[model samples]
Target: MGWALAGRARSTDEQVLELLEPYAGNRHRICRLIRLAGARAARFGPRLAPQEHRFH
Candidate 1:
């Protein structure tokens, strides 16, 4: 899932949302992953700017 998310983060226009879409019903998991990804991105830097829709 990590590799897929990393690839999708760089490969797709949607960034992380495409990977998280299947878990839309699980808000906690979605937020957890987003935080985790943000932390990782903070350490390594983001490949792209995340979309604003995520915080909505």
Candidate 2:
């Protein structure tokens, strides 16, 4: 089966940041999660959209 790793995440900013750090180039597992988080936050909360747009 294909790996749908979108839902796998810890419950902390630092932890999420740490995971995404290695994918700073926007091409890795952690990076994808970061993108998903941003979209979700923006869809549910406008304030966080600006922060998420910075990466993409």
Candidate 3:
């Protein structure tokens, strides 16, 4: 999955907001959700990789 994005260009903040706008209520709420998701990933993502490798 990471490889899929390796060659892709990153979207700007505005583009991200636009893309998520339909599913999300508004810009502020979307930004908050993004922030919370980022924080959760930062905290737990590292631990997940090793566990995933073990399962595979």
| Residue pairs with backbone atoms closer than 3 Å in model 3 (clashes) | none
For model 3, the superposed segments whose C-alpha errors exceed 4 Å read 1-9, 39-56
Candidate 3 overall Cα lDDT vs. reference?
0.46
Q: What TM-score does model 3 achieve against the real structure? A: 0.33
Worst window of 10 by summed lDDT in candidate 1: 1-10
Candidate number with greatest TM-score: 3
Q: Give the candidates in order of TM-score, highest first.
A: 3, 1, 2
Which digits, one per residue and each the tens of the lDDT, describe model 3 over residues 1-56? Answer: 11121222455666655566665657567556656665322122334343354544
Encode model 1's per-residue lDDT on 1-56: one tens digit a residue. 33445642244446556666778798567667757776333246558876687654
Q: Candidate 2, residue 36: CA error in Å?
A: 7.5
CA displacement after TM-score superposition, residue 21 of candidate 2 (Å): 1.1
Give the number of the best model, judged by lDDT: 1
Task: Give me the displacement of residue 29 in model 2, in angstroms.
Answer: 9.0
Task: Please give the TM-score that candidate 1 achieves against the real structure.
Answer: 0.32
Per-candidate Cα lDDT values, in order, are 0.57, 0.47, 0.46
Give lDDT tens digits, candidate 2, residues 1-56.
01222354334655555555656776465555646665442124346434454555
